[model samples]
Target: MSTLPTLICLHGGFHGPGYWGPLVSLLADKGFRSITPHLLFGGTDKPIQSLEPVIEQVAKLVAEETSKGKDVVMINHSFGSFAGCSAIKGFTSKDPSKLSDQNSGKALGIITISGFFPEHEVSLAAMAAASRTARGAPDPATAPQLPFKPTEEGLLEYDGDPVHSFYNDLPLQEAQKWAAELENMSQFVFATGGGVYAGWMDVPVWYLLCEADNMMELPQQQSYVKKARDSGGDVTTREIDAGHSPMLSRPVEVAKFVQEAVASFSR
Candidate 1:
């Protein structure tokens, strides 16, 4: 493979690839080729649902690119974590030989940011459950979250402003900027769950948990880290003081996490 690593950025629902634009540019400036696929689930005319198809598409892209000598790494945010895992399953299933080379250095190393990890038989942690069971819960009328879906005009959006509270550590202006840009967000991710999760990969994994995150909350992030660590892979954790969109609120921290994760491989 060529000597440089390719970073794939996956956005959650409602928003398209644009959510990863700033992060992609930052990585590009550092000499990394980044790819952000348009998951045509919410806004686009493309039929992008079902974890299987999405995983297949990611496998095809990884195979096509790695075949040409580019190492692949995926950095997933929120529900995009599921997508990254799905892709890994697809890649290994289609070409088991590629995975046989434990030190091939061409495998996917994922970094899930501000995401969740289920416990035991639980497939996912419902946002509603967090609210319903959460002691001292905020007034329901103040911050009500809607189930993800589409409206007229083919554009989609979601309710709940937990992100703001989650990201309270960030400067208000930055949070508002993200919120404005994120209004078109979708709820398709709400239905997409029970991913074809992989056991583990030889490649390194680093999860960036926003300490003040409100959407997934602190407890959920902890659960995810524990799962990854217990999953029998080279997993690591990086806790950030910012919110869900650390790239926007804290790009340098995110960039450094990426740099250090891929520093060992002979891409």
Candidate 2:
């Protein structure tokens, strides 16, 4: 039997690796192995003053897998997409359009679910600011801020109700249970774009656009997809009628989509 590339699952801010349990189990049942790293920026137990640690952790995991002759497919959600870029730098499959010396790394492709895409040298904060301006923020002082509130110890907490923000498609009881698992993420995460490299330009990219997502609205998600495609990145998108946490509300569909990517990689 041909070996499937290992799945490297990266979770978003305010979430731990446990959040990927449902999707991971489903993929495992289909004979695909997965690795979900517990990124430190999302942990409330420690202070994460920068994105360097998160990037280093993911890069180390990818390096280890490639060292063992195991190709990987990176799957990231929400803020995890930004970090994923830096981690897969030297490991991505070469882009035909971009001339580069990195041609032998074992990463086959990338998948982003309701994820952010950063332009080269443009920070997430800068992107957000540009978005605010495009929407005609009449006054900088009166414009709406990011959906996070300052918590103790320089951590940033989600300002919206978790149920409505992430798990609207899930049952009330189940949504509340998952919501409670969220943590106060590092404030430094969104402060800079240190981890935002254009790795997507180096590989085939699949984007799962959550139409019902409250956190990342559909327009914003579509805009990112368009931007990526215009920049000569090989990006394809699949629209799903689910909330931000599709892995919980629609694990079967998510699994099937991932399997589709795996099948394509084998070709």
lDDT digits (tens) for residues 66-91 of candidate 2: 77767789899998987787677777
Question: For residue 254, what is the lDDT in candidate 1?
Answer: 87
Worst 10 residues of 2 by lDDT: 95-104
Query: RMSD per prediction, one decimal?
Result: 4.9, 3.0
| lDDT by residue for model 1 (1-267), tens | 246678878776545567576677787888888889865444544344444556566667676666665568877887666666566553442344644343333555777788644222223435336535654667888965554446564345555563454346667776666556554533343444545455244456677878877666778677657656777656777788876677767777788888877774333
What are the Cα lDDT values of the candidates? 0.62, 0.82
Candidate 2 segments whose C-alpha is farther than 4 A from its true place: 95-105, 138-142
lDDT, candidate 1, residue 244?
A: 68
Best by lDDT: 2
Q: Distance (Å) between predicted and true CA of 175, model 2?
A: 0.5
TM-score for all models, in order of appearance: 0.74, 0.91
